[model samples]
Target: MRGYPGRFDPLIYYGKLRLNQTIITKRLTPIKVDRGSRSATATLPRIQPRIIGATYLMIALLADIGGTKSQLALMNEQGAFIHRRTVLNHEHPSFDALVDQFLHTQPPPQCAILAVAGPVDDGIRCRMTNLNWLIDGVALQQRLQLKFVNLLNDLQATAWSMTDPGVQSRLGMLRGSGLNFEQPVVVISPGTGLGQACIQPHQDQYVIQGTEGGHKTIAPFNRLSAELILQHWQQYDYPPSWENWFSGSGFSRLFQTMFPGAPVPDNATMGQQAISDPDSSSARCMELFTQAIYAEAGNLVLQYLAWGGVIVAGGIPPKLGKLFCQPEHIAYIERKNEYLDRLSAVPVALCQEADAPLTGAATYCKQRWHESS
Candidate 1:
């Protein structure tokens, strides 16, 4: 994996691919206005700033900001992955501290596009749901001396990566009658949290958009499942959302709910036990987690009309691919639709690759760089 050629030239390799750069730049453009002087007359662009150095080597920094771990990579303008590293969020007290450590060991890039785990405002301020940190885009750019900086939702990064060749290596192929590039694609990932995004054709290019659909109220198909979720929520006073059932920690909650009196181990301990002993209760928890994930995937497919198909990419699904591939799990997915004839026609697949987010981020940055250059 370390020896792989990571970068590509869009002009040489993807000139005919019809890449979408307009949405990215338009979304990332800074809103011009005075910071302290709120008067309309003072809204003009600041005039005294001197010009910076010309023709700095264009490099892209891609970061995956997840709940448990954050992965960062540096790619050159030519699309080659030059450096890659991962850091545990638990080890850092703040987001700035993590960035400081990352930059201390590896130099900052010219341009940076980070896939954060939450929504990004126009000014680039973001708040990760599972992690305790506030990310300020303007501050980060000024501190790192970056020419360009853009922030995207992590699921959107996964969606953009679907078009890359590297993603093909990790995506399991499924042939279905209705699957086509012209149709929308839905991506549902289950990890520390449940994430959803959609990719749709926008004019000559595709737009990958994020949705907080995971937090939507989960309507159970069966009375037993409904009662179980409701009871768990009632007992814990937690919201009855898809993330409460589809995520890794959600598994432990569900398991404890089901077993009631069984000893509940923490996520790391449970993972270790599950790996060492497949027959442990930890494994059972994972099995149930996969079931909920499949159910959510089916829901997203119907809601999005993802005829381009559904792709499951996350730390959880890929780790438990074999468990997800079981007959019962597959049956559960197929059983959700009364319109089986129509649903069976749609392609459903899993993404087993680890570096999909990184690849997607690289692709996004390269496209933007080409458009601006």
Candidate 2:
């Protein structure tokens, strides 16, 4: 069956008062209001707040669609997620089928916000980078009778994740301190591929700009890094990119580059070995990966003028743990002679929340829904 029987126009209930569209609350916490001033403030009680005119609440389907897995959830305007679930991409026959199954027992979402692991071509359709699936926003909007559907580059979603306090709480400072939110912020995520995005403050909201910085020409931070580039160039018949030595595939690729004749383990196993066995080749590979990450982050910080901060997200960094907190990692970022002070002053943080992308999608959806309302 089609996931929905008819168009969904969410109905909201707040105690005895029934609102038409929006549910306004901060982090799902009860909101208190000054009825005379017609303003709201965060409070502890679940008192019924006066809403002006029709309330504008929308329940959105949020999906972090990646090559290996997809995290699906329904997020209300209060920024609370319900029924979050992760499903293997391959286990489902198609993305549409996967969404249908996920929504099988739930009411159809009013809108859908999808974060996809690929470039959003024409701001609508996306062809998965490492999979055969294709996500089309317009098609989904029609099929589900949704108000709107938006596709974001996965990195764009990760950048927006900072809007959620749940994500902010898990952020571990790798280096530097103090955050200046007035300036731009950047996010670099290395998983199946390298992703980059920047968040620019606009009035009271934020504008997320996706970047293809990962595909930029590679610059060797050191001699060994230079040698790997040559190795990749010789074998692949093209100059290497930052993603070559910076992403999840970097583990296996680095292992192969170091030991030409040895069979390389899978990326996960190599990452574990890097953490557990310091003297092994895996650790050495991780070392290079760490340096590349720092080096590129420095470049991005300078390029974006991201004094707000640089957030390092994705599946790989969290697994590296304190391995990334080493001072040597920041050394790569601070190698800039003139800008060392500026780069050093910018806080570099590690995002530990695995559901960061989903949170981001929810934030994006909520913002768009408000705009529409």
Candidate 3:
């Protein structure tokens, strides 16, 4: 793909100002930091001196590309965050356009790791499931003339962030049960669409496997849910997949079915109503939505035997933190027929930090180039 025509302009600044660049900087657009998570502006500890060698100043560029927006960050090999920027996906015609925009305004990094919202094939090609875009790491690397480019499934990137100190510090316990690090870790994120991934510990490192589990038909937990599934089935040839009822579109569908007489609003409008008015019909829809999600979370835990833990990530879950972490929801998730005890032992937690996927992409870059630094 051809990059948008532009000369490198140093005047336009899109990202956060560097720590050393300005004493008091103003953000062009404020990023809403998650209240439950540690502040991004927290004072960083001093970096230790390297023995008999100068510290590498080379930075790695990281990108978390999703359906709605793309978050980009710059960090040193030492894993210190330098700056970040957010670009709405619609702002660029293609993925290449977005990358070109960033590259034009900033000095190119040694390498880049991009966490995209679809499976990265063996050839490093990913056709975004929710957006009309194709991303090929090899092609992008050649076009940018970067030393290296790594592609990771967005959920795979979120999975990797579990090991990041910043992510770990922000995790608030939903289910207080202890986690067995020896077992596999699974992350289920429901955003514009549903995404599920599992990370298993290998000999010395972890292996992340992104799953199309979201496309699998979901078995209803109750008679009403079963009927709803049937309704969804009647409307489409395909079976009611997890994604059909667990994402933003899912929320809209549920709201429509429950209140057919009312004007069917979009997912964003419904979400605002639910969050603002507890007694509203939207809130009732959210209650059912919460139940369905909890049931699915339990199924994932059992399906993968993810005793290492179950992490609920994405834009939705963390926003409904109060609803997600309710004791009743955990109780519902833990209600497997014979495996209730097994499920109970698997900790369920909300990923408070929204930058988790971006951070995870940075982690991959850090691992690959830390020794060089």
Per-residue accuracy of model 2 over 1-373 as CA lDDT, tens digit each: 0111113332333322223444444223555655575876643323243223433234679999988899999875566775789999999988999999998987568889899988898767999988899888899989988988999988888888886666777788777664556889888888778888888989889899898999998888888988878878787867777886679766666678878888898887887888889998888888888888888988888888888888888888888876788887767876776688777788888888777788898888878876775
Full-model lDDT for every candidate: 0.69, 0.78, 0.73
Q: Positional deviation of 38 in candidate 1, in angstroms?
A: 42
User: Candidate 2 or 3, higher TM-score?
Assistant: 2
| Model 1 stretches with alpha carbons more than 4 Å out | 1-57, 88-108, 174-179, 233-239, 268-284
Q: What's the TM-score of each model vs. the native?
A: 0.74, 0.83, 0.78
TM-score for candidate 2, residues paired by index: 0.83
Task: Encode model 1's per-residue lDDT on 80-124: one tens digit a residue.
Answer: 666788999999998778877776756457777888888778737
- Which residue ranges in model 2 land beyond 4 Å of their true spot? 1-57, 231-236
Tens-digit lDDT string for candidate 3 (1-373): 1111112111223322223233223334333434466644422212233111322335577899888899988775557766678999998999988888876766567678899888788737899978999998888878776667888888888888876666767787787654445778788888777878887877656677777788888888767778877777777887777787778767766777677668877777777787888899887787777777778878887878787887888889877766787778667677667787777777877887778888888877766664332
Ranking by TM-score: 2, 3, 1
Q: Among these predicted structures, which one has the highest lDDT?
A: 2
Q: Comparing candidate 1 with candidate 2, which one achieves the higher TM-score?
A: 2
lDDT of 2 at 229: 82
